[model samples]
Target: MKPIDPRLLRYARATRLFLTAVVALGAVGAGLLVAQAMLIAEVVVGAFQHSMAAAELRTPLLLLVAVACGRALVGWLTELAAH
Candidate 1:
């Protein structure tokens, strides 16, 4: 019936901090996912539709890699925080 259980707040103070970390990591992970999708779309459209050269697609491709790595890191961090 309660949004947040009062017992948790009273008995598990560390949980508040842990929950905050999890929420922040979740947001970061979601943003990274969106960035990854957008970058992939950009690269695909540039290469296939626009017939762009490799040089033109380089930046987006590199950014896509970075975003992928970031997502991995976020996942690792979430796991660490959960445990």
Candidate 2:
């Protein structure tokens, strides 16, 4: 086949970047899900074993959720920026 144009190569680059961002989003979502589960488990376990009070659990759980949301927002921003 003949050589492709530079513009075509740029399309390929954008497509690759889009795909990379998609994969990163998936990986980040999965990772956040796992981490959230682990953190909740840790909180419960610590509360039971170490006798942590109610207020102590609330802040950490809220923080974990906030961080997960932040990760999601980052993924979205990355995709938008790539475009």
Q: Best-fitting candidate, measured by TM-score?
A: 1
Model 2: lDDT to the true structure? 0.79
Screening candidate 1 with a backbone cut-off below 3 angstroms (N, C-alpha, C), the clashing residue pairs are none
Model 1 weakest lDDT span, ten residues long: 9-18
Best model number under lDDT? 1
Model 2, residue 13: distance off in Å is: 4.1
22-76 per-residue lDDT for model 1 (tens digits): 8999999999999999999999999999999999999999999999999999999
Q: Cα lDDT of all candidates, in order?
A: 0.93, 0.79
Residue range 1-83, candidate 2, lDDT tens digits: 98889999888886986778777877776777788788888788879998999787887788688867877786676668566
* Candidate 2: RMSD to truth: 3.8
